[model samples]
Target: MAQRLLLRRFVSVTLRGSSGPVGSRSSARLPRLSSLSWHGTGPPSHHRAGPTAARGFCVSHASGGIFNVQDQADFTDRVINNEKPVLVDFHATWCAPCRVLGPRLEKMVAKQQGKIVMAKVDIDDHTDLALEYKVTVVPTVIAVKDGDIVDRFVGVKSEDDLEVFIKKLI
Candidate 1:
């Protein structure tokens, strides 16, 4: 019974706690946030937060939405050697901040058009990549170019702050 109560409390706190950008947006008023569910039963759609049916890719926001990095080789091909700068989001599905920051990031990156691209590495699925980056926390964003990390940030950042960071990379 206590375990069940603890679980309930967790859910409640999670629901009320920082959903990152969403929670911040809501602070101005009673924010009507849609359900923060990570999964859906329907087929994969570009509009949903799903990597399950992407064959590999996860959620893509705006034009620069999240791109999935399957392994080291994939990372090398897509991020390190790419002609354009790449912003890698080291995240997990269970991370509430990731959920909120991701879409907002997509929107921001989209504005950049071909200037840059975004890569997503699921820490749970790609443990090696996360460990190599020394990501002890979720929602870590890294900027890479020509096989080097140019810049990075940890945890939730305001849209303006993120935009400022992205400005440095691209």
Candidate 2:
């Protein structure tokens, strides 16, 4: 089945770290998936000029951070379509709690490599998404099961609490 294949790919990508369409790197050295940001100067030459703020999300890899999709379409294809459950952090650039939770979530991503896919959305930049999900607070975490939000937590949660929540899901 497609789900089984996706699950296998997810496990392979996590464990072997060398099998996905995307190149692999040790989870330790890689920037947390959600830590990828683009606050730098003008757009790269490859891209046409545009409002810098409107540019898509950027994902930082070992080689360099590259532009990633900022829309829900791409996110669904890359994340929700995958077989593994996903943990999405809805955050904002200026929120203090979001900043505090960012790195912690990254650390969790590294530790739980194969088990879950961690993604982040900057609620400030993606207001529609935040509104659709009814995420009124910064640092709102939602767990997606088979592409549907099945669990959610607001505010900062300890690693133990997160772990316990995730364990219950699996």
Model 1 deviation from native, Cα RMSD in Å: 11.3
lDDT of 2 by residue, 89-110 (tens): 8886657888888777767666
Model 2 misplaced regions, further than 4 Å: 1-57, 60-69
Which clashing pairs does model 2 show?
Answer: none
Q: What is the alpha-carbon lDDT for the whole of candidate 1?
A: 0.69
Q: What's the TM-score of every candidate structure?
A: 0.64, 0.62
Native-referenced Cα lDDT, model 2: 0.61
lDDT of 1 by residue, 1-170 (tens): 23433553454354454443323543324223212322233323232221222233455445544577878998888888888888999987768999998887777888886788889887766778887898988899999977799888899999999899989987
